[model samples]
Target: MNDKNTTQFNHENVKVGEETSPTLLRFFRRKWLGIWQSNPPGMGLFVFGLCIAVIMAIPIVYVIWRSLFAGIDRWQRLLDERIPQLLWNTLSLAGAVTVSTMIIGVSLAWIVIRTDIPGKKAWRWLLAMPLTVPPYVGAVTYIIVFGRSGWARDLWQSTPWLVNALGDYSINIYSFGGVFLVLTMFTYPYVYLIASASLRKMNRNYEEAAYSQGMSTSEVFWKVNLPLLRPAIGAGGILVSLYVLGDFGTIAMLRYVTFTAAIYFQRASFDTASAAVLSLVLILLTVAILWIESKTRRKNKYYQTSNTYRKPLTLKLGKWKPFVLFYVSVVFFVSVILPIGVLVYWSRIGIRMGALDGRFFGFAINSLKVSGFAALLCMLFSMPIIYLKGRYPSLITKVIEKLSYAGYALPGVIVALGFVFIFNNHLPRLYGTFYIVALAFVVRFLPQAMQAGEASLSLISPRIDEAARSLGYPPWKVMLKVILPNMLPGVLAGGALVFVSAIKELPATLMLRPPNFDTLAVRVYFEASESIYHLAAPAALLIVLVSVVPLRYMLKKY
Candidate 1:
């Protein structure tokens, strides 16, 4: 009886252990997961962010899979024939642009930011204002003014005195070299803006210390300041590279055979399978560039100072200031002022002809719709990752951050192509809609939103929320009452940036626009292509004007 009772108790204890084991597991899960979950506010923010990220990522995966797997045999054939050529052409342009933008942008940034250039204040804003002019629009200006049948070329041809003195081949504005020149002009601002911002905010005490140790001024700047600004330069360079890689307007207009151009051709040729495949390959190349940027940036990490200081040390350029001023003037003239003059001249021509009156209202209204929606949607999507990384900050968070950023480096063509593949087959209801294009824009540009929100929220202290808890406020209420007021400005700034970029966007807008719909960007492109140059002017000018606001804001930040 005793033995039997002991056996029965042992068996009962084993069953009890099994049942209690789950209870313990549940308790542990709730405890650990609560770190992420109990902040119902943050979790809600994260879920909101994740939906945006997943939406953004969907096109990329779809494009890759459809292009690669839909017709494996066809992609294989192209892989052997056209892919290599397309890849090389695309990468070569990206590489060349990257190197050129770095050199020009760094020089321009250093001169304007660190030295005592004449008109630094106005020039600073003016220099960055060129970004307001879309590369395609710039290309259009360069073409109509200087092409073989161009007004300038025609005048030069007619002027016998100057024509005899100067050869006809003085300006070949429609060539590979021309594309590079135009791209470098607009793209350098990306680097310049960021580098200049870094330079201004940087404490000059480090350089002063180097000078005090017997280093020359130049040596101190080169050795101390430049090295310190490596991360800044790297960050700026990455932005330039991404722009060059993804830009289709300038390349397409210049007749350059970039991957973006090639993919567009593939899509138009009723060879979407090929387009999808090429887009996948192109995205992979962008991924490689991003990886390189990440590795290079790791070598130099400079964070904002814990304490602020005034009293910037000014090393007199003395003899070089005039030279610097002249150089900057030429760059500013060619890239910024000259382009605006061209557009203004064209706009006046259009107004005098009474051409811009009829569709102006409709076009402007349509532009606002697209730009506003894109900005709102992109911000909505970016909020999750921004909050997650801002609050939780773990390896998982980092992975999610990196994943979300991957779509950013991708060319808009790849993103568009991905959408084209997915929408054409699976979601037939979305096959031809403005929302589809907006979704692509969100995916292609989520990082901009994330960066903005992340910068804004990361500045807020977690203690604010903890303090709210101490006062017995609910997590959601604390967030709504305390954190949101602080975060709103940043989120709006980011969304505004997205709004500006979407307004000026070219290729995706061109490819994905609903039939009969016309945004300013598209209006300018088609009208310009058809050589209704004057008709495209008001739209072009408006694009520049609209884009100017964010460009100014970004210039200040950089």
Candidate 2:
């Protein structure tokens, strides 16, 4: 009996073991298969997105890592000697620019949107035209008009009474004040565009309610309209602040020292470790500003909850019409007319001097090559990520989307520094090639492409994705064959934007361009620095013209 029981127990154990083993194996197999088969984004799409994200993230990651191990002495030395001044300069400039932009942008947006200003249509586009001129180019224009040898200086010197009164053509375009003025002029458009849109869309109920309570027009404006504009104001403020932080060309050209300028000089001096440390600090400052903006935005939720939407009435400027028109005209003239006129005048001189000769054409061709490549890559890369995000809506997709914007938030100098460390250390073959510069451009401007493409893709229904899948198209194939064709206009527009931005990009190109491989932006920077206006003007003018595409795009978008 004992022997029989032992054999039965052994048989039972063998049967249980057999059942458990295949069950576990099947579970594991199904889980593994699910990654490839259970979703719209199959293994291929997911891997491609992952690869792009990793590449996007690697430079930033490398910079952070490099900074962490850059030696405590280097950190201490920079912190004591450099960090204090840089922090003050960067933060103060950012704050000053943000505030000035807010005031100007909000006032201009209000005047255009709420008041009965003449030629509102013309005023709208003209006001936004400054955006077409890059701040650095604007700086150059201001320098031409206000620097020691500028037209203003010449006029002041030539006019004896003015020179005696103003004391020696004392307008220094290389000072902090100059940087502030140039940035404010170009960046106010950010606020103006957004605030104008918000003003237009704002529900009339709140203002009417305020009026019913016997509130004055001025009171209603302050209490009702201004409160509603906070979100737009916050968004514009963040943009301006971030731009100020990342600006290399404007700040550097104006001879004002900020973190970006300091980092560039450090890198130039071969102090890579110190540069990395400084970059990390700048990154922290950027994060801090973004965080504060976020916190402020979150705390103030001004949603127009009423479903009944009515457009607000446009107020007659009455006796104030002339003043308002004058203000608008002056803003337009200073921001748009002056800078562009200078470029055109100088360009005419440049052309007369054979600025569009073989060498000029070569620079133009070089600009086209790298910028075109970057734009194409951005358009191509943007599709998969936007596709995955729009369709999948998973954590992985969200992370990928965020990673792709890493370079956009980073300053060009920092991005260039990251690429320098990465390429010099690992990608030796591509280290000094224009390809690296193109890639950096891709990183820096990919978000612009993504935003445009995502705007287009969001309008598309997932049913289209489903139908394509039902017809046996894989996710990748659907994106390529169906989605891409539908979204091609927006994608192309996005590509155009990237192209313009890459064409204007200065610091990254400066850092990454191969020796003797000068593009238009490079030529502009070097030529302008050396006071070679004739050479710089053509490229600067071309860039300005190309930039108009985005201005039109923004006008439509806003």
Winning candidate number (TM-score): 2
Q: Model 1: how far is 187 from its true place, Å?
A: 1.2
Tens digits of per-residue lDDT for model 1 on 137-251?
Answer: 9988888877778878889888898877887747777677888888888888888887787778778667667878999877887887788778877887888878887889888
In candidate 2, which residue pairs get closer than 3 Å at backbone N, Cα or C atoms, i.e. clash?
Answer: none
Clashes of 1: 2
* lDDT (0 to 1) per candidate: 0.79, 0.91
Give the worst 10-residue stretch by lDDT in candidate 1: 35-44
**Full-model lDDT, candidate 1:** 0.79
lDDT of 2 by residue, 402-421 (tens): 99999999899999999999
